[model samples]
Target: MRASLLLLAAVVTLWGAHWPIMKVGLAHVGPLWFNALRFLTGGLSLFLVVALLGRLRVPPRRDWPLLLSVGLGQMMLFGVLVMYALRHVPAGRSAVLAYTTTLWVTPLSVLILGETVSRRKVVGTVLGLAGIAVLFNPLTLDWSDRAVVVGNLILLVAALVWALCILHIRAYRGLSSTLELAPWQMLLAAVPVTGAALWIEGPHPGDGTLTFFLVAAYAGPLATGFCFWAVNQLTARLPAATFSNAMLAVPMSGILFSAAALGDLPSGPVLLGMAIILAGMATVVAAERR
Candidate 1:
């Protein structure tokens, strides 16, 4: 339990940091190209790691459904949609909106997974969502702006797509361990993303600066590859709703990371929102312990 908790913390931290790092990467590349490169780099890095560990093998046939589900649904579609949205939305706001996955996951878990969520978990989810509302503060947005409205809507769709993938991950009854299959899943995602980049954005070469490569290294290997693997590991260990709710911390940490990296400092409302999110996460953890 302690180990799982620790791993969850690490995953949240990496994913939180990824938002700002991703924004930096976008400066050097088009959204689609950047998305493609991120998956390609992540897939190759994980493949290398699996090979070095002598654990590399073709995924079993039974695992293909799950591979396709997560690769296409979670990694590819989610990444593409969010990247496009980020063109118009701020990273911190995008992080908060994208994690609306908690809202979709909670009810879906009960409906599809047939899991009984405890009262505490329900309360925790509500608290976490309330915190998200605080952070988002719809009044601040220029709703009249078409690009921003569309971008925000796309983010919600991305969240729903991610929620569906989470349910599928919970339902998977496959042979290969998640780590062994991760590289292949990422490979599957990379193909379509790269194709889309070519079709939509043309064959334009992106920035080749040393800084771009540095950012790509972090975004691909550590954030996308390792973080996705860690998340799947935790998903298998915890209830879907519990795990999803706990992820509310991602945006809180993203806000802080953005402040440090992008100079988008958190205001009083942001701090309050972070506190509420922490409380909500703590509530979920307490429920899980019981």
Candidate 2:
């Protein structure tokens, strides 16, 4: 349990820190192009590792549907939305909004899996909505500014879709060799990312700077490849509620990292929203624990 907690902590920290690094990468690469290269590098590296370990094999036909769901919904769509949102959203706010996947998961679970929604989850959902309202500050929002509104909506949708994918994974009862299969999922998601990069956003704008290469290496190999493995491993070992609650640390870490690495301090409004969201999530966690 101690080792599991430590590993989970390490994984979240790595994931959180990657947000700023991604911001840096985007300055040099287009969203789709960056993700395509990142996924390809990460996926190919994992494939090599699995092959070297002699664990690589052809997945059964039965696995294809679930694999595609995860690859497309979780990786491809989620990654693309996040990358695009980061173009306009502040890193700290983006992290907080993205991690609302916790709130999304409960409703998705109830709807898709016929699970009962406790009163606490309902309260959590309401509070989560309130936080979003605060974050948006509707009274002052300019309807003409499409970027902020679109970015926030995209992040919310990304979080919801990712929640659905998590529930999908939980429903699959026979997922053996998740580590071995993960590379294939990454590669599957890479197809659309690569295609979109080629068709919609042709040619890299980067000047081949050392910073670009550094960020790409971190985002692709350490953050994507290693973190994916860690998430799967931890998910298999931990309780769902416990895992969700523990991952709250991720957005906190992201906020701090953004402040230090990217100088993205949370404003008064953002801080308020974050506090409310955390309280709501804590309520949900406490209810689950009970």
How high is each candidate's TM-score?
Answer: 0.97, 0.85
lDDT of candidate 1? Answer: 0.89
lDDT of 2: 0.78
* Pairs clashing within candidate 2: none
208-288: candidate 1 lDDT, tens digit per residue: 898788887887888889988888888888998789888888988898899999999998888888888888888898998
- Backbone clash total for model 2 is 0
Worst 10 residues of 2 by lDDT: 238-247
Return the top candidate by TM-score: 1
Error (Å) of candidate 1 at residue 103 is 0.4
